[model samples]
Target: MDKELKQLDNTFRKLPQYPTKVIQFGEGNFLRAFIDWQIQQMNKQGLFQGGVAVVQPIDRGMTKVLDEQDDLYTTLLEGKLNGQKVQDHEIIESINETIRPYEDYQSYLDLAKNDDIQFIFSNTTEAGIAFDENDNLTDQPQNSYPGKLTALLYERFKLGKKGFQIIPCELINHNGNTLKEIVLKYAQLWDLGQDFVDWINQENDFYATLVDRIVPGYPKERAADLEKEWNYHDRLIVKAEPFLIFVIEGDKKLEKLLPLKEAGLNVVVTDDMQPYRNRKVSLLNGPHTTMSPIARLAGIDTVGQVMKDPDFYKFINDEMYQEIIPTVALPEQELNDYAEGVKERFENPYVNHELSSIALNSISKFQARLLPTFKRYFAKEKKLPLRITLALASYLKIYAGKADFAPEDTPEVLAEFKELRQKDNYVQATLADEKLWGEDLTQFPGLIDLVKQDLQIIDQQGSRKAVQMINEKED
Candidate 1:
């Protein structure tokens, strides 16, 4: 067996450190596998001469372990690349060092002073950008991500330095705009004066970015076998799918700052990322959420298997092409191309995306990913979309214990399900639960009856048989 690997030990050649040109906020698997890996590729091509300094946004994080390994880690890229199974692995040497902001606040602010630092990237989770009024400006490192950012921006504004191009890759919609609003709120709450606000508004450019990549991260189950093959005992060996798409809503001139397009990366630096965002959320995410419960009930496990199965495949495509695409606002050809790409991504040979994993908090996921499309499809067609409604029925069935599918929801949600199961008018009652769907879904005419009918069919037949019936009815 190979020895445990650390940085710059004679086992591997030492890499020359470039100037820290990007200050990143999250050192987690997603950023490391996606963003840092992209930077490593650009640096290898000699197109980008920079390094990333990852800061641990929260106190309890992986910075200590990262620092122990000298910030070096391996990324295993495995998935179908252009219809061929490919597995590529490389040691990512892009991170210069990691910093814990809570311990060394001044050092964190000092990053803003670096002349070469032109970009700031972050993926601090969806809830990370929230405004925390309890966080004061004087508190070391501040409490929230935006609070720390506002403090750092005020420091840089005081020094009269050039502003950094900020792009937050948080999963929320319009993440950069939301973060900017919170930072402005913090500036006002902290009484940092109007000049700092102006500097923040005029100097820095915060771009809303949508990042897509499936980083399963740190294959614990296969680590020993993988370590034996690679002849290295790297702890941070992350696993990611081959598919990646980054859509950034930014000033076109700023593309020069992040010139990874030459490296053949699928980076769309567009002014309107909403359409791209819609395409991904609707076409990619919508189908995934809609298919999870139904697929699980059908005894299917992975997404690739769902695509390969004839009946499940037809059910997914019918939902996409008939209902989902009509709700999206994009060019016909463009949307069609994007849908095809999403299908390819779903069929990635190497990735085994479990339906149960996707089924976590599925009620909430349906509201965010599929509900808008469901409403829009009804509005345009003036009729309920059958497959989406059936998917809803499948979701309810899974939660109600009618199907053998296990669900992961809040106790409150499970309680509601239990109450609904006990009710005589369970279908109508559950459909009218405003707390679950934000608004009563029953307000849409024909929705209640259609869902009730689908539920009856699903109850009588199996999910796979119901899928066949859906396809036949669609045909």
Candidate 2:
């Protein structure tokens, strides 16, 4: 710790001047390490010639820190690559300026007049694209991300300028379309009229994008070691996984604007990103949701520990290949390859991904990540999926206060779980709750029985023994 004190006053490098062609919302770690780094890579390849002007979506954000350092930051990428451990680092120089809209509303509105700007990239989180009727067109700064964006678009429209290619990186199912819908709703609410609405609908193009990258953000434990290695002090330092893919549902025209693919980056501009989205949600997130509870109940903490455990590992691998893969519409080889990557990511040596972290809001996660595949399996086989139902049972067990870590969820959900814990037929009651799983899961052929059976095994044999038994029984 004393050795780290040697460079406490060291300065970070500054970015080069480039025309701000992109307006970025949310200057968080993921954006800096993924999108900004991609732009820097494109810039380095000379395939793209532009920089980003980050807009502060919320009143309180990292814009002050970003402005202090001339919007410069270092990104560190670490993970396994083809059975070999590797690390990559870059001083991301894609951000030319930062804007705090709350501080200077006029300056924020003036960004629309910048003719060089052609693209707007946003990752204002999943709930950021919501409609708030409280916001007005004449407000200094609007309440929601959609509201702020609407104000900007109206400004650009009144100036008679062409609209931007707005790409939304939110994790919602249809992020771009959702954002557009909310923006249009705001237009209607504020009485912005037909011509302004027409300008928004016709001139601008909103894209649904799936950005996959695990940015753990600011390696606090090893910051001193990193600072010692880099010989600089960067308060905005971000650590990211080596693997990332940006799947964008947009036109061929967007491909020409930002040549991220041309630079050999993992940017896929496709007519349909649903296949990729499904592949990711199922193969990647499904395993995460499934493994967390079972492993946590079995006294496991991190995902790396889960991978090391023979039973938990087998459960994940079997669940993905046997139950989850067939449900996704992607090609066989693609699914298998992605499954391999997900397993690798689960065992990333550098990250300690806590099962407790993934265990938050287990109900919603199970509904979104695993239920579709579970339903599909039921449709195809007319039988319950052994591995998936076990996962569901594991979720119920943990929520029933069978684990060391306290389960996290909405208060309403927690209260319901508390009530369900008192029921005699707990699994049946839980499955019949349509508000929990979106539909009565008990209606599925033999689902309730399967869950009850798994719950019995978990109760008697313990989570570890249950996992081992399930895999061994299948084999």
TM-score winner among the candidates? 2
The per-candidate count of clashes, in order, stands at 0, 0
Tens-digit lDDT string for candidate 1 (1-475): 3456323322453456788999999998889999999999888888887999898998888888877667888898897767778799888889987888889988998887788998989987654766778899889978888998888888888888988899999866788898999999998998989988888899899999888887767777787788777776777888889878899998987668788887889899988899778888899889998899888887998788999998999899888899998889899789899889888888876666777767767877788788889889888998888788888989988888877756787555788898888999888898899867879988999888887777777778777887888798843
Q: What is the per-residue lDDT of model 2 for residues 347-380, given as tens digits with 9 covering 90 to 100?
A: 8988666677667677877887888889998888
Q: What is the lDDT of candidate 1?
A: 0.84
Report the C-alpha displacement of residue 322, candidate 1, in angstroms.
1.9
- Judge candidate 1 at residue 270 and give its lDDT: 89
| TM-score on alpha carbons, each prediction | 0.80, 0.82
Please state the error at residue 279 of candidate 1 in Å.
Answer: 2.5
Clashing pairs in 1: none
